[model samples]
Target: MRRSTLFLVAFFSLFILLNSDTRPDSTDTSKSVTQEKVLSHSDKTTTETEHHGAAPSPYMVIPFLLLLLLIAIAPLFFQHFWEHNYHRIAIFLGLIVTTYYATVLNDFVSLKHTLVEYLSFIALLSSLFVASGGILIKVDKKATPIVNTLFLLFGAVISNVIGTTGASMLLIRPFMRMNKDRIKSYHIIFFIFVVSNAGGALTPIGDPPLFLGFLKGVPFFWVVEQVWLIWIIAIALILAIFFMLDMNNKAGAKEDQQYSGKIEFKGLKNLGYLAIIIVSVFLDPAVMSWVPSLDPLPVGIREIIMFGVVFAAYKTADKNVLKANEFDFGPIKEVAYLFVGIFFTMIPALRVIADLAKENSDVFTSSLFYWATGALSSFLDNAPTYLNFMSAAMGKFGFDLNGGAAQTQLFLQNPDAIQYLTAISVGAVFFGAMTYIGNGPNFMVKSIAESAGVRVPTFIEYIIKYSLPILLPVYAVIWFFFFRG
Candidate 1:
């Protein structure tokens, strides 16, 4: 309790410091103007300049790197300490970066933007986590290789409808239950690869990055039109691999239990709450002009609605269903706390990447776009990475990212522009499967599986054992077949 109080006090202190002196000083006006010129030349808005400040010193990225390193290693080496104080550690590291931006850089706008983004992120994730937890699914069938493969395939498809986060939160518990007798780390890993990331590539509703693209003037159906083939090829390849792996495992249900081949479901009303959450995703002013803006405040009506769902869903949830699902707050809490640090410290890293991408826009090819966007999206937030690369791609064709839907349509009409955009979209969505932190759903899935006593891999093990060996080859094939030009 004392620790929780300290955490709140420190958080508000950081907030107060950032909000105190947001106006630029007279002495800094000239520098701000010069920085604005560079930013504008890069096709960024003045608002973006306010959000990112000048080109951050590359050295400023150290805190982000360090936080990621600690997140990866601390749990492996210092399990107890990390499990207990991760929130404090995350806040402490976030404070370092926030203090730098607030005092040394005097760029409170960036801090505020990060805060808003963090809130929206948490609001969406927490709502889905809570709402889905109230529902219970029981699959009374023997876990077979074909059955598991089909289940994952269905999950991938529905991900486009309810979103990767929604699908993951809804299906993971049932999936674990079905495979309880033979569940392995590979089961969860493949789930992450297919449902949580690659499955979401076909629609804006499927993933945050694609949704941002839709807001930026890309047609709502454009992703499906462009990437459907790539999505099919990738998902098929992944599912095949999962099938082959599953075939080798001979584990079956215990001798005392028999399969009834029946599926049981409860808490159907939460589906209405999920539909409301999905509808609320479009409540942003950027998407619906009729939606009022809450400028200066990071969140708007959408976030408020989603957060309200979190409270309402939990309060009205059936106790029997909740107990059946073993629902708790542990997974969401971990994602919320760790991601705050990630969002704060990653400001400079994103800025540096944005600057580099813009400066070299003229020379970049579609292949480069795929790899660069994919590499960064593996660690940083894929949504912003998608936007940054799209901005650079648009600049390469003499267009502005903020030039409204007409300008974006004009850019998309160019054959070359389509190629670049496709690569960026695919990279951002597909490569998000490369790490647990790549997308919002990955970590939550991992946390849920662990809480259920699944033997999940460590962060490094996930990368070295599964990602490099499996996903890397598949992504290379995708690039070769589609974006090699």
Candidate 2:
């Protein structure tokens, strides 16, 4: 984990240097911070909005973006001097940056007209939140290979309900406890594969991208329809791979580690928590908008909703449980911090891509476009990335807003919109496994596992070991056989 952190710092350092002029931080001499804030006439540092009406000068775009990137990452270097709740500084900075960028970038009018208001964004974040408690749990004594397999199954099953992170928090301690006697137990990696990533594919609530899809236009029950197929395929592959690997680990087998355990209904009985999740969704566009729908949530009800959740969580989850798992708000805070800068700084790229879609609609229709968008989405922000491709498809493919095909020249005269949408969706969701930043949960999973003392691979190492070797093949197989030729 430390190594991965170092690697990421280095990577971002390179990013800062290569895009030097665009860095947005406040310098010792320079009074202004690009995306972070701009001191207003009123003395309040306000959002550093981009020129969002239409296309700005091409020269302005790159320089402004570089300035924004610098502002975004500027905090990393200063924490050594001032260490009291410094992370919060980044969080607020992120909020300012994302807000400024989204508001100031080209075509705010179009974005406002099309996508739901800023409230929806907040709702989306709230909906994605999930967590659980974990105590040390040992496996059943005298258990065999079947026991290990069952443990994996149990954790995987819980993932969809409570989320990958939740299931990890709930079952990982016990999962590790059960296998504690073995010195070479690499079972934890398989746990991450099945319990963390694959398991989250079943429901919108299970992962952020899927949740984002549901909030957009994708149906709620669509994922449920594929439950068995996705789950079985993911689980089978993981089991087969893990079992084969375990068989090779003579050291683990040599230790006659006695283990015995039963399912704790605390995690299972809390199944009722899904109901709270449902209520939360209704609160999104359906109800929350009605309450104090006047001022922008950033300046109004957004704070109320944020406070509301904190109050509820404090009152609900047991203190011991929270403490045991060390349920700090760090992960979500990190999301809030990092993504704000990302959304703001990358508006240029997004607008550029959006313009590309507007100009060349055929690009969205081609198979090359689908895979390419998905592949790039593996590295970029999949949401805006998805939107860019979607916009292109909408303009060119000539489909209705529902993503249905146009009924003219052939079965579907213009298939660009739907094709692009599918490509973007699939790319954002599946290939996200390639890198940590692709999806919110990717790094969260790694950090959580490491917090539990697991040996997580470095950022580059993750791609080399797991993604390219294991995930890409499975995703490719699924894509070639089902999606494309």
Candidate 3:
């Protein structure tokens, strides 16, 4: 705790010294866009926006790095404290970061935007958790290598609809159950690669980071068009590798007790609730345009609808169904706490990256953006990391992504900027498979696999043995074929 406190103090002291000059200059105006229009379109903003286009000093990004470092190291070194008190650690850092943004910088507009983004982010994740938890799929099938590969294929496709978390939760157990008699650690590892991370590249609804992109003004269908080919190639190569690996492994004797029922889906009503959530996300912006008086009505309405769906699912679904799924609030709560800090501390990093991208546009080609975003995403949570790179790309092009339809149009029209955007999106989603902490579902899948008596690899073991050898080569192929000019 004391170390965390001292780190916060050092972070803020450095930030204060770096950003001593707070006043905007003449160049700030020309580069900065219309703040009112930007605010009117996004979340939790007052009618004020600032176009301080002078590149932010890089030292101001220390807090963001500190937050990422804590997230990476805390679980490894202080498991008990991190598991039990992650929220407290997150709150401590979040408070200091928020105070810095609100008081020292007096830039509450951007801060509010970040806060709103966090809220929308948690709301969507929680709603998916609740809705998907209610629906349970029970399968009674033998675990052949072909069956296992096909199930993974199904999960990879369903990930775009039910989300990586939802699809992972809904299927991991069934896959584990079928393969219980002949399980290998590699089975769980491949599941994480295909279902938990790479599968989510196709759509905004597929992953938390992509959903963040959707909320930030990227069109709902943009990811599909941009990432579909990469998604196909990645998933195909992963499934093929898993099949080969399974073929080489020797199977143990079958379990004495076998499940003897047809494939069943309990709490089916949650599917309807899930559909409602998807439709609300898709229609939020377009609906908001129809109601002129309600300038910032969509986020609130979407959030309300999301919460309502959660409530309805909780009330309608049986307690036994949730118990069967081992549904709990720990994951969602962790995401909420940590992301609040990430969203706030990332302000300067995003601003600086954008400024650098604009001035040194040649430095940010498609391949460089791909590897940079993918490497960071492999260790840190991919959502904020995705937003950071997107902000940089937007900065490179000298425009805010907050200008909903107009910004989308601008991106579609600019081929170079679109290439960077596509590379960032693909890298953020695919490389999340490199480590357990990279995506929300990776650890969850690992936990579920362990509870079912599969001895999963330790963090380093998993990355070095499985990810580096298998996944890295596949990603290299993606870069060579798609991102290389």
Candidate 4:
């Protein structure tokens, strides 16, 4: 507890220092369009612009690479040290990059922007984590191939309504409990593939990248309209594979064991909290002009409401339900610590990639866009990758990224631009399953499963055994069928 308190203090202190100079230079209106690109469009007055300095040095990306290496191998090589010290390691690496930006480049705008994103990310995740933790779903049915497949299919469909993170938090426990007799790493892996990634492709509210797209002027239903077919194909193929794998598992309840074949739900009121969190997701000024923006603070009314849900849900939660779910803060704590480092260290890498994409925008096609966005989003944050590629694609036809809703509408009117946008959307959402760090929920789900005593694969093992073998082929099929032009 002392260590946790200290860690929180250190984090907020650093955040305060980083935002001490939140005043944007109104006189700097002559900056290039790249420099002027708005990091967060929700707040008109306090929007974070891209760093207005010379492009970041490519060598500045070393810290990010090192962190990734540590994340991938440390648990396998030195489990004790990694478990106890990971927070320190993540924060240290993050501070290294934060110092470089503040002292060397004197660029606080980018830091503030990344910090805001981190807050928003953590707020939503923690709220959903707490709220879902309060609700316990128990399935007493026999675990059969068809039943498991239907369970995954239901998770896939509802993911479009509640968002990937929400759906993942809400269903993972029940799914695991249902398969307790034969739960394996592959079960969790397939959950990540379908529910946490590709399943969210059908709605803007389903994923952060698509939500950003909606804020930039895409219609609310544009995602479902454009990618419904792709979503069906990807989900169906993955579920089919999962079904085949489940058939081989000989583990099951004993022949004489009885089953209730009923579904039990508890802590019903937390569903209201869940509903509040979902509704608060759209309370951004960019989405609704009446929503107030809390500029310079990085968080807004939505985040405030989410953090409140985190508190209220926990306080009102039934003790029995919490115990049944084995609810604890372990998973969220790990994600919050590690992702702070990722969000900070990857800033230079994102800026570099954005520059390269812009420089070669004219030569890029939908296929190239698909591959490039997928490759980077597999490791980096997918939301910004989606935005960067969308910007570059728009620039291909001479549209400003900061041109807001009207400009985005114009860009979409072009038939070719529609193709590029479709590819970018699918690639960003689908490829997020390629790695644990690819999306916020992937790591959280892995942690939850690990805490439940399921033997999860190592990070490298996950890629080598599961993702590379399963997801890559499916994604290739998607590209061939949809983005081949």
Score each candidate by Cα lDDT. 0.86, 0.49, 0.72, 0.87
Tens-place lDDT per residue, model 2, 1-485, is 34534543443343233332332323212332531132211111011121124563354345334433343334345534323433333334433433444445423322221122222333334333432331323345433456677777877777777666556555666666555545232465566666665666667666555555554445666555534564576567767777777666554434553333454433332333434544554443312335333222122343344345544544565666566566666665555444444444445565666666567766444465557666766655665565455545554645322221122122223344334444555555556556665655555555555676766665556667867787777767655644573
**Candidates' TM-scores?**
0.93, 0.66, 0.81, 0.95
TM-score of 1: 0.93
lDDT of 1 by residue, 1-485 (tens): 36754785678566655555555434334344544333221122123522446556788899899989988899899999988888887787888888888778777767776776778788999999999999998988888999999999999999999999999999999999999989999999999999999999999999988887887789999999999999999999999999999999888787788788899989999998999999999887666667776654556788899999999999999999998888888888888888988998898988888888988999889999999999999999998899889989999989977665677899999999999999999999999999989999999999889888998999999999999999999999999999996
The candidate, 1 or 3, that scores higher on TM-score is 1
Ranking by lDDT: 4, 1, 3, 2
Mark the regions of model 4 whose C-alpha exceeds 4 Å error after superposition: 4-8, 25-52
Give model 2's TM-score versus the native structure. Answer: 0.66
lDDT of 4 by residue, 1-485 (tens): 36855975687677677777755654356545653444344533222333345567888899999999999999999989999988888888888888888889877777877888888889999999999999998889898999999999999898888889989999999999889989999999999999999999988888999988888888888889889998999999999999999999999888898889989999989999989998999988777777766776768899999999999999999999999888899899899999988999998988898888888999889999999999999999998899889988999999966666888899999999999999999999999999999999999999899888899899999999999999999999999999996
Global Cα RMSD, each model: 4.1, 10.6, 5.8, 2.6
Clash pairs of candidate 3? none
Which runs in model 2 stand beyond 4 Å of their true positions? 1-52, 56-131, 134-159, 162-171, 181-193, 223-235, 251-257, 265-274, 286-295, 299-307, 400-423
Deviation in angstroms for 37 in model 2?
Answer: 32
Q: Candidate 2 — what's its lDDT?
A: 0.49
Locate the minimum summed-lDDT window of 10 residues in model 1.
38-47
Candidate 3 wrongly placed segments (more than 4 Å): 1-63, 208-222, 252-261, 286-288, 291-299, 379-404, 414-418, 450-455
lDDT of 2 at 118: 27
Q: In terms of lDDT, which candidate is stronger, 2 or 3?
A: 3
Structure candidate 1, residue pairs in collision: none
